[model samples]
Target: MPSTLFGFTITDHKKVFAIALPMILSNIAAPMLGLVDTAIIGHLPDAIYLSAVAIGAMVVSFIYLLAVFLRMATTGYIAQSFGADNLAEQRQHFNHGLTLAIGLGIAIAIASPWIIDFSLWVVQPDAALIPYASTYIGIRLWSAPAALTILIALGVLLGRQQSGRAMWLAIITNAVNVMMDLVLIIGLDLNVAGAAWASLIADYVTALVGIYWCAKALNWTPALLKIIPDKLSQYLNVNGNIFIRSLVLQLCMATMTGYAARYGSDIVAVNAVLMQFLMLISLGLDGIAYSVEALAGAAKGQQQPERIRYWCKLTLVWSCIFAVFYSLIFWLFGAQIIGLITDLPEIINKAENYLPWIILLPLVGHWSYWFDGVYIGLSLSKGMRNTMILAAGFGFLPLWWAGMPLQNHGLWLALSGFLLMRGLFQALWLRLRWRQVV
Candidate 1:
């Protein structure tokens, strides 16, 4: 018999690990797409190439990441459909998401010129960097359709608990991005434009892979969706809330980066390295959240409230366990990790001062990510929306302003508050009003 924890057998928790392990690795690898681009571009003769790529990558990644609501919304609907054992609805959900993905992608591509101009104007790049940045941005924007398709495809896979497939698709996509970086950026000597093209090509390739995965994974139910006008309205309403939530979350992140910039280049440099640490932790925890989302959605579909409770409690226990380990690992080797990223002595020294925040981060902030899975699975978009607003607007912004005197420390403080509040508010709302709302 397998060992037990918290009143459940290890066998029971395998349900979660089965999904989380591959996903954790995949989530970790996801960053490599951008990292590879930056790494390869960093080798170019002019530092301008690196700066231009960074600006361009940021804008593209921002939009694609924001549209992740497509995945979240799709996952909620798909998992619930899977729970009902209604393969037809699952197929329909996938089709609807794909249709929406393609439409939005084309729309974004057509608007690319205005997007580039507005973004450049807001950013006020070094005058010299504008042409290169604009070039990279323009090229990358065309891949929006493909990139959004990947998100939708991933949603279908994960919602069905086909995480292994999702993980491989992620790995394969990044590998392609890296390979393209070599050919276009290095081999073709295209500089930043080459890097942008690499991403565009890789996105379409991944989109094709996503199509293949969806085809191979689904059991080939022969039915079609008409984009049902009413269904589309429902889709928009659900995802629109999620979009607002995503916007608030991204805005909060941007606010942090802006604050870091105001603190000076050294501070910004330090925060950049530290943000990698944050991103990795968030991504790792997100792996577990994936399992929570699918399992909880299935439980909801089965009309089994107890199963949902079992999962929420179980995930909470494990997340806490991870919190302890994250703290220990970062506490022991945070500096060495910083050294791996940059050789600058000044940045390294400054990074050490803020190392405590990174260590403290997983402990305080991880719950929000963990609970996000629960909320998404239940299709609790409104709760997700409201909590983020409350946390960022009421909690984070005010705290950030009041704590401005402390500089970076203040930023970390406000962020810590924001992260902590997001989960706390969601937990309370779900606990008190879950039945009434859902």
Candidate 2:
């Protein structure tokens, strides 16, 4: 028998890791697609190629991020239903999630031309780079429906504690993406457009694999998908809150990219590399966060407040440990990492100049990621939405404006402050509402 403390057993740690480790692997692989894309484009004759890919990718990412509620809402809902041993409700949630994902994806695809135009206008890339970025977006936008479907499927797997399946989904998708990237960009000599086509093919492949797994696991039938207005209304309500929260976060990111672009292509390229580091850290921590989401949601379903508390404590401890590890890794190997991303000596040197901010990011940013998982698990979207809104509106924007005089340095400072504020404010919210949310 395992030792227990405050209702958390040693077994709980094992359970959490079982769920988290695979997710960590999955999350890490998620970024390899971007890394490979960067590496492919970075070797081009002009830094403009790298900047174009970065801007175009960021635009697509912003659109997807806005609708990420498809995944988060589905995971939270299904985890609760699974914990309560309500098979019928799980099926219902799964169907609802899938329906919404497909519908929203189609809508996004239809709206892509306008979204691309708006994003380009906001980011304000160099005039020469606009065509390259536009080409990338035009091709990748076709993948929206498949990509969104994958999100819902991944959420269903995670909520059901089927982490292995989720890991495979990520691995297969990203692996295909990398291989296709090499073939399309390097082998075919297609450049940025090749990268976009690779992503589109990989996304659809992943969606097919995910849908197959989901149908087989859930024993899903066509008949089960008849949408109930009440259930859908409830689903939309939760997702609406998360959508607003996600939009705020994406806007902040887009704003940062736009600011970086204004400084010139060199700055944009360097920031893109630095942002990859941030993504690596976020994804690694999110492994732990995803576990917490599933476990905490399940605990809530069982009405096990003590278990939720224990999870919160254990998750924080692990998050801090990982944060320290990441900071040290960046400090020690920052140069080597930058070198691998791009051959451009200028971009590499510029990235090295900003390496310290990357080092500090994990430490300042981990708490917000942890709190996001907790809130999502508890279905506390309204609070999550409110926290992000305040952080973005009150904290990030003002800091960004104030730092404008400093150029790239100012932009980075503002971004770092934004991450710190998000963590701090969300921590305060969690502390005050622990009793209620848990």
In candidate 2, which residue ranges exceed 4 Å CA deviation? 1-9, 33-56, 120-136, 178-197, 261-266, 335-355, 405-407
lDDT of 1 at 305: 85
**Which candidate tops lDDT?**
1
lDDT of 2 at 111: 85
- For each candidate, what TM-score against the reference? 0.95, 0.86
**lDDT (CA) for every model shown?**
0.87, 0.86
Candidate 2 has its poorest 10 consecutive residues by lDDT at 1-10
Model 1, 1-438: lDDT tens per residue? 679988877986898888888899888787766576578989999999999988988888898888999999999888888788888777778878988999999999999999999999988999999999999999999999999999998899888999998898888878887898899888999888888887788889888888877866665433554567788788878888999999999998899889788889999989889988886687668878998899888888777888888888888788887888888889999999999999999999999998888999999888998889999888898889999998897779998999899999999988989999998898888989877644
- Range of the 10 consecutive residues with the lowest summed lDDT in candidate 1: 218-227
lDDT of 1: 0.87
The TM-score of candidate 2 is 0.86
Q: What is the lDDT of residue 148 in candidate 1?
A: 94
